[model samples]
Target: MNGLFGENLKYDLKASLVVFLVALPLCLGIAVASGAPPMAGLIAGIVGGIVAGSISGSHVAVSGPAAGLTVIVLDSISSLGGFQLFLGAVVAAGLIQLILGLVKAGVLGYYFPHSVIKGMLTAIGLILILKQIPHALGYDKDHIGDMAFEQMDQHNTFTEIYYAFIYNSPGAIPIVLIGLLILFLFEKPKIKTHKLFGIIPGPLWAVIAGILINETYRFWIPGWQLGGDHLVSIPELTSLGDITSLLTFPDFSLIADPNFWLVAFTVAIIASIETLLSVEAGDKLDPYKRITPASRELVAQGTGNMLSGFIGGLPLTVVIVRTTANVSSGARTKMSAIFHGFLLLILVLAIPGLLNKIPLSCLAAVLFLVGYKLANPAIFIKEYKKGFDQFLPFILTVIAILLTDLLVGIGIGMVVGLFFVIKTNFHRSLVVTELNGNYLVKLQKDVSFLNKAPLMKQLSTIPPGSNVVLNAVKARFIDHDIKELLDDFIETAPNKDIEIILEGFSNHVRQKA
Candidate 1:
């Protein structure tokens, strides 16, 4: 047991470090965009890693407050009168998530249509491309926002494209070019020949190269400044006193507001959906093919959110960005996630100066690649071949998410998927046959409330003065509602001059009906 757990621990630590590096800049950037202190993002990241990761069943999944939630968090904070009040909603949301997990609501994740997942991936990729363009060009007017295409219209992404020629920063071009070069080199087969070079990831190499290029440009030409605004700046917090002062508490007084409950419920639902989706993606990327325990993940997320809220941090959930980075970085266990959180804590305390030097554009390039992979055309083609029932809902899900938001899009897709499933079962069960002088009707598998509508329509349309037989030989289960419907059909059959025969009507079937 020790050996097995030990191996996992080692793997997780390695994975966590990689995830920490990837998550650090993102946490700050997202918090900045959400109109909150940068430290709020870091605090959430720490809680998500240590608190959530410790309890989560997922080996590779990483949790944090995501950019996707920024708008909601910001709005809640504004309306609630302060960030502390918003924290109250987050705490409430965490409790709701915990209750949902206990009720085994995670099963909902399994019912999501494949097409919808594909569509979501595509939409997210498109959004990443649009949002990252501004960052790549050194315009930090807004944070990388939602997965919607139209949302981009409201931000600098639209404006920066037109202004690029007129207001382009000279230093940005070199930094972006160097970052791209690093990415190219990492992808090149020739570079793999070198042992030291092959061990490093493309994103890490790009960050290093970006730093070097910025320093080199500054040294050669003192007037050409590229270091300050273009890069990630670690917030100045000198002592333990400073850190203590930063901590915020939830405003329990806000509990009186009905809007608080509404916001809390919305956050819980959306955060759970996002977490479940990320778990699915993380499992896909796991080399061991391990399936994450969904209920435990919700519990972990809940705990993390609770802690984050207590510390005046943002709401937390399983984020795809850091999880993907963890997988790609060869993370093998949950320790990587925990260690990543620890690393975040240690780095913030010890080496804020070093972190402040890294350029944001370099990070943007890394995210750009991630977005591209998520929305690749190959995924669409792959899902399309799964059949119309699969692809249609997936396409609808993608469009819905892009046009509306994640939860609404997924809800629409789920409804469509449920309809298809019910229709398929109904069509399969519907068998009409002439047995001797009687017309025989047979059901396949189980018949439930979903099959009632179609069954009623078929029964009402049956030819008058015809004999009918209802067979249940193939049905393993039937709902009471369906049995009642059958009873109604029997009572009315004689009035229409139709003879009725019921087969395999056991005591159990009668009770069930």
Candidate 2:
């Protein structure tokens, strides 16, 4: 343990605290969104940090209860008849994921185009900024981790922002603004080098400052104070007994139920997809540019969910928001993720009251910066310069995700990307070059029916007196359609006074009447 983490311990410790702060509210919010006990979210967060972090190959990704699974879990719990039955489904789902990893199904991530992946990241960035605007203004109707365009609160992303503008909280505005300033100040070179400020990251100070300001409001400016829903709202635990009571084990009797298996299969497929996508996003954001084994990540996530269900917890996945927070915080190793789990455990046990004082607006400011870093205008410009083949898919992905959800948006982008791939291949299959009334039509490799129209067009344009050479030596296979086109062109050559020469095609092309 010392050898792996000793060199990066200091960096990881700071990063861990930042991730813990980011994960805390998200965990609770996702639990509420999933219609499960708040303690379940915390348990999943803890296990993801400790068990998944320990078992996974990723250096900076932090796993926890994912927003993507909220709708599935909420509906599944009711369909399965109870939360205990749902817990059984979660355990079974984990086992299915384990089997998928062993079968190397993780390679599905590799088939996605890079442009689509970038689009997914950029979309999440935009979503973070758009979603947090309401929270920053103290509109707490929607949970913090909800990523879908449409919210369960009957407000879409834009509508929520519109409503926030009208009913903004006065106290939260200043706290968020002040928090942003503090975070910006801490990022300055001189402040970062400060003996004390540099050691502890800026987010901790921002949370602390928010607490002090809110407390001051309570005493002197009661009208502008934030409490209840505006605060962190961690489940209070006064004794060790309170902690044990929250734990709920899975009902093993559900193992024989078909409904249980249906829910388990759905959870396993979705969780694996989310994990694969999140890992792709995480690897892109890592400063070290390290690649993680996708199959191993599946195994790690499976292990975490199994353990979480064995006790009481929500389903777990490699969450993009928390993973982004960890990478943006300069996490150096997996210890940061593991330590963040321990911090969550400690928060629930010893300091729920203290953490509860943190204003949600303050955390909003932190995410705002993370969002800006991701969706910077420069990224758009860079992708646009790559041409329509890349830019089209990238922009489409961002729009699709913004309008729909992550998986659907990515699927749309992939279809567009595949279209471009076929279009490019169609054009490049056969090369046509002309010199001084003579033409060399070279087929480089396989020429399929998709390229037949272009090949015919090129062959038809040869002048009446021109000499044409059809080169097929390099082509390993020519579709029957292409061979027929060549035969027709050859038979008509004498009438136009066009000379036809075929190289390495005597066996394939026959003269036709």
TM-scores for every predicted model: 0.84, 0.93
* lDDT (tens digit, per residue) of candidate 1 on 189-245: 777445787566667777787777667877786554466667777777777678787
Model 2: worst 10 consecutive residues (lDDT sum): 1-10
Give the number of the best model, judged by TM-score. Answer: 2
Candidate 2 ranges with C-alpha deviation above 4 Å: 1-4, 252-254, 463-466, 473-477, 483-513
Scored by lDDT, model 1 comes in at: 0.76
The alpha-carbon lDDT assigned to residue 402 of candidate 1 equals: 62
* Backbone atom clashes (below 3 Å) for every candidate: 6, 0
lDDT of candidate 2 over 385-465, digit per residue (tens): 999999999999999999999888988999999999988877778999999999999986778998888888888788899
**Looking at candidate 1, what is the lDDT of residue 404?**
67
Off by over 4 Å in 1: 1-14, 99-107, 145-153, 156-170, 184-194, 219-229, 239-241, 255-262, 433-440, 446-469, 476-502, 505-513
Deviation (Å) of 350 in candidate 2: 1.4
